[model samples]
Target: MPMAADEIVSLIVAGIPDAQVEMTDLAGDNNHWAARVVSESFRGLPRLKQQRAVYAALGDKMGGVLHALQLTTAVPVQE
Candidate 1:
């Protein structure tokens, strides 16, 4: 079964409370998704670490229920 977009957002928000997540259905199928996550907590963290955090939030769902994900992470700009 494919995962719901809200489920992905909820998991990320649950793990990283300050994260702002935007999800897109890349292939018009729930199985393929693109997620852009922006968070103040990501400041000073390496991009690899930031990506890892998001993946960690998704847990084992990445390969099983969720299928493919194109992820982008960023720190919120201070203006």
Candidate 2:
């Protein structure tokens, strides 16, 4: 089964309470997703750790239900 974009966003939000997530289905199959997450939580974290947080949010779904995912994460810029 494929995961819905909402479910993915919800899971990310569930873990990173202050995150802003944008999801796109690269394959139009709902299984291949490209997520752009902007969060204050990532401010000082390394790129690998930032991605890890989002991946952790998804848990086991990463390989089983989600199939493929491309993620980009960034910290919010100060104005």
Choose the strongest candidate by TM-score.
1
Residue 15, model 2: lDDT of 90
What RMSD, rounded to one decimal, does every model reach?
0.7, 0.7
TM-score of model number 1: 0.96
Quantify all predictions' global Cα lDDT against the true fold.
0.93, 0.93
**lDDT (Cα, tens digit) per residue for candidate 2, span 17-79:** 999999999988888899999999999899999999999998988888888999999999999
- In angstroms, the error of model 1 at 23 is 0.4
TM-score of candidate 2 to 2 decimals: 0.95
> Candidate 1, clashing residue pairs?
none
Model 1: lDDT to the true structure: 0.93
Q: What is the lDDT of residue 40 in candidate 1?
A: 90
